[model samples]
Target: MIRRFRLAAVLIATTAVALPGCDRPPEEDTAARPPAPTQNADQPLELTTDSGAPLESRRGEWRDALRALLAAPDADTLATADRRWRDLYDAFNRHYLSLAAQACAGDRQAPLQRLDAWPLYPAYVDALPAWPDSGIVNDPALELSAASLRRQQGATADGEVALGFQPIRLLIAGAKGAPRQAKDLRAEGDEPAAALRERRRTYLKLAADQLQADLNALDRDDGLSLTSLRCALETLDDRLAALQTHRQATAPEEGLYIPSVSVEILEETQPKAALTQLSADANRDARAALESGYPGFQTALDQAVEEDSWAPLGEWLHAHGD
Candidate 1:
């Protein structure tokens, strides 16, 4: 089970393998052991139990896994943390769907709780910046989720208004990270509250631990989180070139990287790929941000480009920041 108060693991995953582009110490060259399988860009990248496992930063498997995911797209390789997360959700969906059928027994909305209506909703919400509280914990399935988080953290009834990482991650990993499906709350009528509450605790221990472990990888030194910056950079490039047409996305940690990178990156974070989505002022700001932030990374990216492989980006991140 996840112990919420547990100290985060500080070490990166260890490995005996070595990658070609990166130049680091013997102990630091923790590449994926057998090399990741190729992934197909056009396919919906299927995830199995092996692809969604949790990780410790010290062991650094998460880093290895991340490199694998980014490096190969027609290959079926997965990082430890990614695999663990997907597996957890695959299991949760089965359990959650079953609970929903029971909760709704007859109606599709037997049990629902609107957390935003609670008097202490504001304070309850401020506590979880990671989750975008929908303000409503609909159906017995979500009600149980909120209750579990509250009990684990020893929070008040008002706190039971929101779901935590365990639930949130399930949503992110599924449906391409789209908004939660519209649940039927108008059909609310009857449900077994006691049984549902009990059921919520069944996977609480496992789910909590998994969520915490992944959280550690992401919060401490996650390659997935860092990779977002790379993706965002590509988006920034497209947006700047067209000025009148491209869309712009803020790099991961755009604000944090302001002093280290460029302020224009955040100057225009809105996506404006087409003319319909364009804004003259915003585009100008985005262009400026590209100029500002591009300098710091370009020197490194240029170095990598001349080498003809993207591998140097990882080495640069190692020397600079995530």
Candidate 2:
């Protein structure tokens, strides 16, 4: 069963907040500044799986592809990375994430899962018409520091996320509604402009590093329980229901990752064929874990999939019992 759910659509709550000033201009001795980290284009990216074979996790594949894209950023690589992200997002939402949530529910050592699925706000990562120079790219305070990047996540009153896939998206895609050129990223103009360009490049590198770090954190068995997988599912269901109501009342802001929202609506309005596949996949994985002598695997999964406010899971089970 191949369950391909679309990536979750993010809801952006807007607010009127004062923008900060750009980072102070670089010092006169620009040569003293540390060079941005560089990756060797010739080196192959290393990806390891639990079985020590080809990588099977979509998340791992996306991470590697993203690394490659960051190493030699170009239009083609950016497109490839975006495709990989979509694949990862779909697989995670439909199957792997559920499994992780269930595991976390039953075990104390389970990896921590993101509750909101790290939704991206384009305005938080890049400049939008209403808030030009509003994102991490233009903010000198966030430039070139992993700590700063991590600290800024969910630190705003308006729920603007400072880290994650969206910042990387803007890094590769340029500003919100503009074509990115090679020259735009290069430091080729006069002193002030060139310094800004250099800062942008440095920020891009830092953003990619921070992204990779976040992904790595998800793989750690750090005694972090993300509560029951059912909680996450129920939360998502509520969000989807609210989204539908919001759309009916008033149109959502345009250009806010509309494709992802559209995909969610399509899944909701369509048949439950995908849900069957998802159930089968979940069952198979649970059995496999049990066969490998993992205690309580089946029990945990059974509890996780129990009927709740998650409409799709409930409807599917009502139509077809486990």
Candidate 3:
């Protein structure tokens, strides 16, 4: 019953207030039907605010804020800004729905707690190979509180054992099949299904060996709990196993053809050159705003504010010092 898109918006409560017919009291409002469709149902739904303001319709004036942040002069500042913007966008785009799920499941401080718990998750997501599209399989933030609780309870060994299996989840999610219908594509070249089966086996074996090695070394020294690292590694192996089983069972006679998932990965990974510019601009604007009320930097600052550019600024200051 939780609304995915509605909960995902930044400052959703403000927009919620602006929504027409939202004032009917919680009981009645919860029963109210959604607003009438402005566009054809055949097309992707055009996102809008509660007041019927268009969101995904046109790029809007807010995009310029992103542009300004990316246009900043300092390379370091820009890099910092880029990371910040990237994290903000990633969090907003990737986990919004997932977060809603958690909140609905009854974690009140779910979002903030996540931010505190797994600081490395966003970076991990950015670095992950984008096969089958981008997403965190089990967002570290979601597990942060529970994981921390285990640590606090002195379940370090047990926790590591569980953590070792986490990567398998990613492997499964990244599989070419699943909710996505990539397996429907036909494999090309003269290689028969038998050959592909062998190849798949080889790939799975190699992946498993690497994963085992990874798991065995969990928590040797990396300050990371042996449990957490192993969870990720084991998860990867289990997913590989599942993928192999699925492929062997359902693989086409022509072999399992996924129209080059690497391309999708690469596309997802394309870096934003504008981030550096945006970051520098944001800082320059923020400083200028402080000195003279932000006329010079207002546009850029607004972008930073809109897209949550403060992340990169903080990172930049941390790396650069003072």
- Which candidate comes out best when scored by TM-score? 2
- Residue-level lDDT of model 3, residues 166-281, one tens digit each, is 22221212233332111211133365533432332232223223323332232122222212221222222222222333322221111221222222221232112222322343
Better of 1 and 3 by TM-score: 1
144-245: candidate 2 lDDT, tens digit per residue: 577765666556532355555445555555543464555546666897667666766677767656655545544443321212332333333333443443
Estimate the overall C-alpha local distance difference test score of candidate 3: 0.25
Off by over 4 Å in 2: 1-64, 99-121, 174-176, 182-184, 187-190, 220-229, 242-274, 281-322
Candidate 3 TM-score, true structure as reference = 0.19
Clashes of 3: 26
lDDT for 147 in candidate 2 is: 77
Q: Total clashes, candidate 2?
A: 0
Cand. 2 Cα-lDDT: 0.43
Q: Name the candidate, 2 or 3, with the larger TM-score value.
A: 2
Against the true structure, what is every candidate's RMSD?
Answer: 22.3, 16.3, 23.6
lDDT for residue 209 in candidate 1, whole number 0-100: 43
When 1 and 3 are scored with lDDT, the better candidate is 1
Scored against the true structure, residue 268 in model 2 reaches a CA lDDT of 46
Q: Ten consecutive residues with minimal summed lDDT in candidate 3?
A: 15-24
